[model samples]
Structures are given as C-alpha cells and as structure tokens.
Target: MGEGIGFEQPETVENKGIADELGRVLESVPPKENYPPDRELQRSILDQLPENLVEELHAHLIVVEGGKEAESSAEESKLRGELFERLATAQYGRAEAGTQDPRLAEELSQELVQLMHDPRRFGLEEQIGGIRNPDLAFFKINDQGKVEIEAAGEVKLGLLTPRAAHQIGGGFREGTRKMVEVVNRMEKPEDSGLLAVAQSRTRGGYLSASENLKVKLIVPADRNPEKVKSLVNRGIFPREDYVRLLELLKNKDEVEILKSAFSRQEVAAMADHLIGKIRERYK
Candidate 1:
C-alpha cells in the first residue's frame, strides 16, 4: 500500500470521497450526551471483536508504521526508542491480542494515524523528522511544490521510564542539537539557522510561568466510571476544564459551538457523561 494510504502525508489529504461512508459507519453512533453518553455500542463492539482481529490490527499498524520511514540506521534506532517508550506506558495503550501487554510499535501506529488527522490542531509531530517507512505520515503539497509532512503515533499512556519520557518529550522539545554538528558543511550558517524551530523557547531560560502553567489534560476515556470519577475528583485531570465531545453531538453544526475536537467545554461535558456509565455491572 502507498504511504499516504496508511495516513502519511495527511495535510494534503483531500476530504473529498469519504463523506458517504462516514454517514453510514457513524450512523450507529448514539446521540450526543450532556456528558459522554455511555458508549455501550462502541464498547460492546470492541469487546466482541475476536482477539485475532486486534492482532491483525496490531500487525498492520506495525507494518504500516515501519514502512512509513526510510531513515538512516541511526534515525531508525532513535524512532524505535520513541515508539518503545510510548508502548511501555501503562495508561495510553490498549491490550495486545491474546495478552494484556501492549505492542508498542502497534499502538504507535494507531496513534500516528490520529495525530495525522489534525481535527484537534495540536502540531505535535511536525518538524525535523524526514520520511522513511512511516505508519501515519500526514503530508500535503503546500502552496509551493514542496511537500510538508506530519507523522503521528500513539502509545499506551504512562509507559515511559521516569527519565525516558522526559528525554523523548525533550527531543520533541529541542530536536537535533547533535545533528547540527554533523551535517553543516555545505549549508551556510544562516541557511542552517533557517531550519531551527522552537529554539527560542529552548534558548530562553524557562520563565516561572512557562514552567508553572498547569496544562489541563483531558481525562482519558476509561473503562470504569466510578473509579475513574473518583480519580477525577482528586484531579487526575483538572475536572473544571473538562469538555466532552459527546455533548457537542446534540448540536448539528457544532463547528460554531465546539470550535475544535479538543474544545474544553465540550470535552468536559462528555467526560461527565462517560463517568456515569463506564462499567455497566458496577453502575
């Protein structure tokens, strides 16, 4: 399959043909909740699917993501470490087929796809990395003939060693300090400078506010509502800032109402609904 087919080069992906299919698959989606309406159907479907299906899903994710990149061995190794960290995390990932343990590479593949479809608009993985066998690279032809790619991936949450996630997040923070030393012969110093991004944030000393500003992370969709809500009450995610997508389902043209997928108001409302019904037996 082509790289774009796997979610690579997504920026340029035309939203032209899939409108019909969306209406159908999405038909089964229940009405929006004042909160995240219990996703009973989605949960049931996910539960009923055979383990092999998940395995196939996992394998395809791995093969496709691996195929997306064609970087040098050094870069490939670096990518592997990043993927590994995502997998090792406990919270952000799904169970592997036939086992509770997660397949880091596979989880990354799925997450990569979500990242490419930037309906949420956080430019997480956009700069510095070039294309190799990427699983879900989002690319599009810009106003110029050149292509701009944004590759994305997922990992089970909380997988990294304490030091590792920070290191990887830091790589994201300041990509290629070491690369500058190695590949600087032909490009003039200014041209080299042109490639720099987010350097100011890195170069500038971290102000107290920059370090202290508490990010309002959305509460992840969990399997157990009461237990999860208890955690939320304790501030797992800043509950006040929560907005759920399900709440927006009530409004037909949510663009004006919700703004984006990650809108705070909608996500928090959805979280409230979801917290009501995560575990049917318990509820």
Candidate 2:
C-alpha cells in the first residue's frame, strides 16, 4: 500500500488434502466438558491420529500436556518452539493461504499481500542478540540485491493463560532490550523494533482473564481492543517509538506481533498430531 509494500497475490498452495485432514481431526474432537480436558482423554484422541498425519503435521505442532504442570521435557519444548518458529516463518512467507477456513484464508492472503511487498525478505532465528536471538526478522533488499535489516521481531508461543501472558511480557521486555542494545551498538540503529507473541489452540479463550490483566497493564488504553481477535487475523501491531520501551520498560509495552498465523482449527489438528508423536517419543 506504500513504497515498499505492494498488493501482489501469492501463488496458491495445493494443500486441500492437508487442510481437509486437519479439519476432520478437529471435527472429531469431542466437546470438552472442562477447560484443559482430561489428560487421558486428550492423549487417547491424539493417539487416534494417523501416523502419516502426525509426521506431516509435526512441524506445525506444539505439544503441551497436563495443563498447568506440563509434561513436555526441556528438549521437547525447545524442539517444539523451534518448529513453531519455522512454521510461523513459512506461514508469513506463504501468507497462510493453506488454512481451511475460507474467511481466515482470505484475511491472511490480504494481510500478506499488503505486508510482504517487493524487495523485502522474511527470515527466522537471526542472531540479533549477543546471547539471545529474535525468532523472526525482516530485511530490505537494495538495488544491488544486498539484504539489510529493516526490522527485527521476537516470537513466543504457548497457551494464552495469565502465566503465559506475563511470561510473554517479560520475555518481550528482555528480548526487546537486547534488540535495542544490539542495534545501538551499530553505527546507525534501526528506528523501531517488533515484539511478537502467539498462543496455542490446545486451550481456548481469547484475551482470557489473565491475558486481559496483562493487556491492561501493558497496552495503552486507547490502542487496546475491546475484543482481541485471534492472532491469525491480526498480524503485526507496530509502534513507532522504540525509545519509549528503552526508557519506560514497564509502562509502554509495544508488542507488534501478537498472533499466530495458524487458525484455531489448524492448531488443534497440529497439537493433536504432536501429542501423538511426543507420547511415542517419551514412552
């Protein structure tokens, strides 16, 4: 819509079968009588997924069992986090047109067309922090085709609980500080930065009580949404001022990337698929 951003249609991805399979798996999930649902029941449902689907969806999955007390190991969590990071990168690259939900697909396509324009590139896990790394970064290509950093972003994925929400806030605070510190070390610091967080579909509730509190504590009153939509729909919420974060770390929390590109249905299927894989791996 501007100099760098353009409206170019992304090539259609042939993933109807994958989408249909994911849909079938989601539809098969019984209505949850409880918030987290029974662990055995959850495990059994995951066990029902076809082995091939588990393999195909592994890269898109984040397996977290036992609700508050998650059973996933550190290595497993690290692997899942990295896998989700890559998945988010690919989703941004493709603009998530492969999702089954038509409305969500259209929204993603439009956002992608608007956000990803010519002469810009998206990357994952750049070592922007001396001891830390932002999960995602955006680069600009000059006339000579050399890539230069336009912006940097951090990514966090977990259930949208109060604890997770607070963790996201703290993580972004520290990560953003690192980003600013590193950028300042350069001859010319980037004007702005992005802090992104995403939540899994294993648990449901948009802007849950804890999330609401965290949002109220961080997000500006005027900018905060009355009802926070799924992260799939709202991509990046940019803030112009970076110094505000450096100066007032607690008061002005500008989180740019807040949603996962994957819709609820897609995340559900992937979570189930990963649960199956994790069970086998740990057993």
Candidate 3:
C-alpha cells in the first residue's frame, strides 16, 4: 500500500503541551453573539499563540470561513471551492475499502493511486485538455511502479442547483469521453475509466439529470443514517445502492486535526513562511 501524509501517532509531550495551550487560547474567544471580535482583542489572542500556531490557525480559518465577510463574494466563493476540493482529496486519500465501501476493494487493492489536487497548477493543461481535466485527478501506480492517470473527479460547493447539476453531468460525460480516447492510445490501458462528482450538500435538483451520468456522487455523510435515507427518498440522492457518503471535518474538527498533524519543528518552519502574509492581512 502506498503511504500518504497520514496523521502522526504517539504525540510527544511537547506537542501535547502546545495543543493544550492552543486549545485554551481558542476557548478564550467570546461567544458568537460578539463575533468578529474587537481587533485589538483578536490581536491579543493572536499574540498569545506561538508565531507558528498563529499562522496555521489563520490559514485554517481562511479555509473554514472563506475569509472575512468584508472580502468580495467571488473571492469567498473561490476559497470555499478550494476548501471543498482539499476536503475531498483528504477523504479519498485516507479511505479504507472495507470501511468506506466494499465496492472500493478493486481500486484500493492495487498499488494505491495518489490523487493530485489542481493538476493544472503543475502545467498539465497540454497533457490533459483544460476543460477535460478535473479538480482532482487519480494517478495509479501500475505494475511496473509507473504512475499514470487512471480517473478524475470534480468538486462543487454550495447547493446543487439545476445549472450545477447540468455542469456535473456534462463534465462527467466529456471527461469520460476524453479519458477513453487517451487510455485507448496508452501502451497499457486499463479496462475502465472512472469519474466522480463531489458536492457540499446533496439537497437540490440533480436526481433526474444525474440518473444516467455514470459518475459516482460523493457527499458528506450525515451522523444519522436515517437522515441519509431521507435524502434518498426526497430524490436528492439516488437509491441506496448508488450512495457514497464520506465524513468530512467541521472547522473545529479540522483545527484539532491540524494541531496533532504537525510537530513543533515543522510548525515553526511553516510559521516562518506565513508570518509576513498573516501580518499584512490581519493588520
């Protein structure tokens, strides 16, 4: 099995101390009624955090909150899209076949595929047509230990409206068509191609449109199975056989996870890079 940046275990005593201190700092913030707390008050809280913790927390908050409300709606939308994309990548990256879905066994049994985020940033547009390229691409490790594109996924945030549903279904068709052509020309082509769509919420008018898209629709799992069944009945999702739910992290949960994922030294290194950005933005 291929290794990912999985969470580290056996937390060091020093790391535990840092987490405790950070937790206390976070808890000190006044309730939501007085939210967007006083600038000086926020700064004082930031001051208590180690430079690195401040940076990590700031970056995480941007992802979770989609930046300050004062920012342009377009910018906020972009940030929210980014958050969803990263969450989808993390969810699939750590997925266990049996735990997530027995249907995933075939994909998970092979040399694990690494899912790349925003492949276009790596200047892959020429290799994979710009429109056809997905927000996330699955590159499989072949028998010879060579990595090659195996599948693709698109992520959509916000309610799944009619337009969004059309985009999702159409994109799946186009992407699959493109992948079929590319794989056919490959020296060692796989038998099938896969495309997936991930959305923030399952509520919307997508059921009829997506009935025959041949794409896997991934949505965050509700804590109650009955809630998910309700969605299926409402036609927000297809039948039970077609539903694939992933548990995504909430803002607070993500904060806690980030605290445990980094070591003191790693945090310090990241902090150094983010210090200037944080200062300029927060000020």
Candidate 4:
C-alpha cells in the first residue's frame, strides 16, 4: 500500500536481521553448472523480503509467472512490460492506484519493492525514445545523488534453447545502442558508453557470468536463427544495426552468452522451489 509496499525508500532498505538465517539455509543448496544454485538464489532473496511485501512477492513469482506457456507469451510479455513501466513512476510513484491498471499496477507495486531494495544492482526502467527501450535501466548516482544511466536490462520468462536464447544478447545490443544514441544526441558523445543486463527464467539454476565484462548477460536461454531472423525483420532493429547485432551474437562467448536453455517444466520446477522457500519463511 506504500510506495514500495508498506512504504519504504528503496535505497535505505536494511537486512531486517534475516541475512544470517538465509546464509545458513543457503549452505544446503548444491552447486550447479551455473553460479549460485537456483534454490539458493531464491532463499537469499527470501531473507530480504519485508513482512508486508511477502505475500505479494510470492504471488508475483508464482501466479504471474505461472500463467505463461513460454517466456515470450503475449500475456506474460504484456505484464512484464507494465511492470517495467510502472516501476519508473519514480521511487515513490504518486500514481494513484485507482487511476492505473489495477492488476498490472498491483503486480508492479509488489515487484517494485524488491527492485528498490537494490536499485543500483537492478535496472528498474530505462525509457529513452524510439523503439529502443530497456525493461530495466541500471544507473549510477553522481556525487550529488543525480542518477546517470549506465546500463540497460531486458527480462524474459522462459527456459530457452541454445539457439533461441541468443535473442537476449540481441536485446542487449539493441538497448545499448539506443542508450548510446541518446547520450550522443544530448551533445555528450563522451557519455556514449553503456552496459547491458540479460535476465531470464531458467530451470537448472540461476547462472551468471561476466565478472570482467562491461555488458552483463545473466540468463542462459538458447537461440533460434529462424525466430531470431523473424524478430530482426519485424523492425526491432534497423537492417544495418541488425547486421551488426548478428555479428555481436556470433562473436559473443556462448559460455558467457548462454549456458543452456530450459523448458517450461524447468521454469516451473525452479519457481516452485523458490516459492516453497518463501512459504517456509513467511507462511
């Protein structure tokens, strides 16, 4: 009911004395091919939930994510898009609940609480203009606390095949290009640098790479050349830009770009595991 569920500033959120408990529970999580096993990642996040937001957070992860057959499903994409847009309504968005899309706004209200808990680490919403908008845009605060856009993020909801997952990287390239173009247009071409985050829902575990790269591609979904080509032709990217995007995809490190794409069953398995953890702690 508050700006971020029960009303709190995103940056000032504290551990609520649950970090140690989570750390203990996390030890039981087995290591997987990806860093920070899926279950463990879920448990870690569980410890961060504020009391008021727990129920809503649980619904967001389970109910909303459950209704999708594929991560790219139309309904799922639309909801995710709404979440991204509402999240940018400013930290304590003044938008009255009555004036907005009730279901979508409610979900965003819940997710926003989690996101604000770590604004710097997660890009909430990056809207620049053109078809180049990122679901979440990462930022850095200047000395005066002014935010400067540093990176962009895209979120997908399904386990991808190796070929199908390359879409995320393509998304990254498109987002970075847009951010850079915006910076240049503002007459600060030196600020043309940007970072990208690729977030996806997978089955095996929560995997992340690029401890040493400018762009951060976190999800390991697969790719489909045909589908990828279709998306490109749809005008997500201009022809020339699409060509470069393809090169970026080919030159990208697979180990770094995508590890393995999973199935809906896998997505359900991971979410259920996480939801169970949340219930154990809060219910």
Output the number of the TM-score-best candidate.
Answer: 3
lDDT of each: 0.28, 0.35, 0.35, 0.36
Residues 139-230 of candidate 4: C-alpha lDDT, one tens digit per residue: 33222322233333433343333333343545444544544343333332112222211111111111121222233233322333334343
Poorest lDDT segment (10 consecutive residues) of candidate 4? 196-205
lDDT of 1 by residue, 73-110 (tens): 43333433332332222222343344311243234234
TM-score of each: 0.24, 0.36, 0.37, 0.34
Q: For every model in order, what is the number of clashing pairs?
A: 42, 1, 0, 13
1-283 in candidate 3: lDDT tens per residue?
A: 7888866444333245444544454445443431332334322323333334445545665655556532444433444444344445544433333332322323431222211222244333354454433444333332233323334444444334333344344554565455434433433222222222111001110111122333333342211222333223324544432243212112222111111121222223333333435456775
Runs in model 4 with CA error above 4 Å?
A: 1-21, 32-53, 61-135, 140-148, 155-215, 220-247, 250-274, 277-283
Q: Note each model's CA RMSD in angstroms.
A: 17.9, 16.1, 14.7, 15.5
| Sort by TM-score, top down from the best | 3, 2, 4, 1
Which candidate wins on lDDT? 4
lDDT of 2 by residue, 6-96 (tens): 4433221233344445446555655433223233432333333333544543433333332232435553564445445544544433222
Error of 2 at 214 (Å): 21
Residue 148 lDDT in candidate 2: 28
